[model samples]
Target: MDKLGNDELATILKWVQDPHDRKSLSLVCKRWCKIEGFNKVSLRIFEPNSLHKFLPRFPNLLKFESSETISDTQMIFLAKTCPKIQRLNLKFDTFDASNDFGDHGLFALSKGCSNLRSVILRKRRGIRDGGVASLAKFLKNLVNLDLGFCKMITDEALETIGKMGSLRSLNLQGCCLISDLGLSFLANGILGKSLVYLVLAECDRISDVGVMELMNLRCLEELNVAECGPKVTDIGGKAIAAMESLKRLNLSWLINVSDDTVFALAEISKNLVSLDLTGCEMITGDGIRAFASHKCLCEIVLTSVNKFNANDLEELVFGCKSLEFVRVDARLRSWIPVTEQGNIFRPNCWISWRL
Candidate 1:
């Protein structure tokens, strides 16, 4: 190994995708350890106190994830050490009191990491609109941002997010405070043209009025409004279908969705590849059967569906050659034919039936 140059050794190490294997290789010799540490571009750590030690080791880190609550000091350390960071995922352990990294840490990070392209901040109660505003002030190159389960955020923060013109993906799952007006800000904001993927799952306050605004986002490819309020019905569904670029749609737990909405989706979204209709009590076999002709559809989840019988499923599989996986209610397992059950183990397609 000593005969190989550092660049060549690093190139060889690139093939070692498994972290454990890489760790073992690093222990082989002092030179290998130094090369491995120097070449490492991604790192994830669960311990908060060890941030200083690890931050200096990976000078070229482009992606970093701190599983624990990273404090303000540690965030500053990370930003200073890894100035070239492109993606950062900061998660807070709610049970741990000491993991208090609030807006101050976020401000420090935003000030130092101007080139950050993507960021995920999950379950951080300390973050509010102020932190989001801080992020918008800098991080102009950011492409994706996830604030899932950040309960403290309000609609005011979205106004700042709308200013992020480069953002392509945004997730506000479980952000209960966001209303229809906040969504309007995103739709009319500068980022609307660039935004392609959006997740509004469990944002119960959002209704058809808010969703209708999103119809203007022609570039939208994926959307998830699962578990939303009853106000999201056929009107919003039709609007969603009009998004020609949409490929993946999740309408799970939408109690008001019916056959008309499903048919609209099947007719309009020809390029759609994946769909989740789980817990849609109002959708029947007639609605789902419309998907039989969808050429690009690969995966579907129909858990707790009441309308689709064994025959409907059989016909669906026979028509959609691209169908790869189907997740259905366990009770329907016995409804499928024994011959088709044998096909479950086939390379091309399979079924997952569970409680």
Candidate 2:
């Protein structure tokens, strides 16, 4: 048999049972060294030298989860090696807020990756406004981006991201450093044009004023604001309800939202598919009734709402034919027709009522 070609080696390396066997093949010759692909993937970083050793091992990896110290050279190696990488997760745990991923690595990866899609940078203290600005310069076909807990980013970075009009999903959770000023930049720049799924959980400083800007998203579908501003009360709920295309909504821990939110939302978003009112305590039976009126409402999660009784929930189930998932507390009345998809309801959590 002719010596295994690089393509064949790449295929065999994926299925090889032992890591030593894979490395043994990789060290076969210079031809194997230049295979233009890699297989080693894990979340290990030994201060400064582990990256130097493992950076060039896998050039065409699909998924990368990195946590420890990230250097500029390692960033370049990964970007150039894994040109078509689809998912990348980069998180930094330090509070130093140093710009770790510089513009050079970001720009290179953005330009090199053709099939790139989902990118998440959670708690990344190394990525700042300048690094992101360069990254967005090349990522024009991006779909999902999560900048959760990236505290050093500013409005200018968001402005760069706005250039990608094809973006559908975005998560800005835990970025307490960015104010509505940055959000204002995002809303006015590109998010309003193409965004569908948005998550702004735990971004406390943002008030309704920032949300007011997002109302412009014509194709917006899902929104999650589990912990944010004082404005996320009925007023903001009403603002979100104004969007006709909204399908899924999460207002789990909003303190100020009352029955008014339910009343307002009942009329505006007729196409709602799923809803999460987990901790909105002020809403009683009336709020649930409002949600019941939605014809397309499917899954509902009301985990900690104190006011809603069983009658209201039953009415909601009766109103929507599409409802499949329901989560409530232990105090409410039992459901009408006990049905658990594929599983038996062994334990009864509510009182039985027939009126």
Candidate 3:
């Protein structure tokens, strides 16, 4: 081991996949520890308060994750120490009472870490429009951004994001402050050309007008507008059907959408693979059966949609050859015969009876 060079040691370290084994290697000697720190690319800081003490050891880190309530000072230190970081995850499951981290830290990080490609700030209350704007302005290579549950951001933040041509995925789930105008900004700019995945679930402020604007995103493949209030009716649903590139869609709890939207989706969306229509009380047996002729639909969720009977399910199971999974109300299990249920499962499709 004494004869081996730093390059050879790093090559051997590459094969050490186990964290415990890597920790043991780092303890062998000061030289080994220094080499290990230099080679470390990803790190998850359990105690962000002590970041300044240990972070300096890993200057070439590409990814950093912390679930703790990291303060502004710690974040600034990290940004300066690890300028090459490409992915950062600062998701907090619970809100912090201290509110020590905010836009100042975010601005500093964005200025220092210009190479950031993916950032997840889910459930962060401190991040407002100013921070987001700074991120959009500095991180030009950023592709995926998750601002879910960041309730303070409004249309102003989206206006900055709409200009980010390289951004491909955005999550605004639970951002109630954003309205139809924000959606229009995202739909009209260069960002529309690249964005393929978007989540707008629980954003109740958005209605048919906002949803209609999404049709301009020609490359969008997956969308989630579940639980977006009763304002989204057949008009919004029909607009979604226009996106031929859509592969997965969640229209759950959209109670106002009727058979027309279903028929449109069945006939228009050729690549649709997964669809969730749970709690869609307005859709009936005819609406459910419309998907029988669809070629690419494989997974569907109809739990709580009581209008469809067992006969409609039977036709759907028999007609759609690509179907592999179906979720329905538990009450429907007794309506279908045991032999038919067995037959349904035998043909590579499984049913999930939800209570």
TM-score of each: 0.86, 0.79, 0.97
Ranked candidates, highest TM-score first: 3, 1, 2
State in Å the error of residue 250, model 3: 0.2
| Candidate 2: stretches off by over 4 Å | 3-48, 92-115, 333-355
Report the error of model 2 at residue 281, Å: 1.8
* TM-score, prediction 3: 0.97
Clash pairs (backbone) in predicted model 3 = none
How many steric overlaps are in each model, in order?
0, 3, 0
- Give the distance in Å from residue 143's predicted Cα in candidate 2 to where it truly belongs: 1.9
Tens-digit per-residue lDDT, 1-355, candidate 2 = 1577767866765687675775576677766655533545433344544655655666656777766666677777777766767777766566554546655666666677756777777776666777676556667677898888877666677777767688898888877776677677777776678998888888887777777777877888998888785666677788888988899899888988888887877888888888888888888888888766676777777878878766677677666556666777755544333453213222322212222
- lDDT of each model, Cα atoms only? 0.87, 0.71, 0.92
lDDT of 3 by residue, 46-105 (tens): 888788888998999999998889888888999999999999998887866265578889
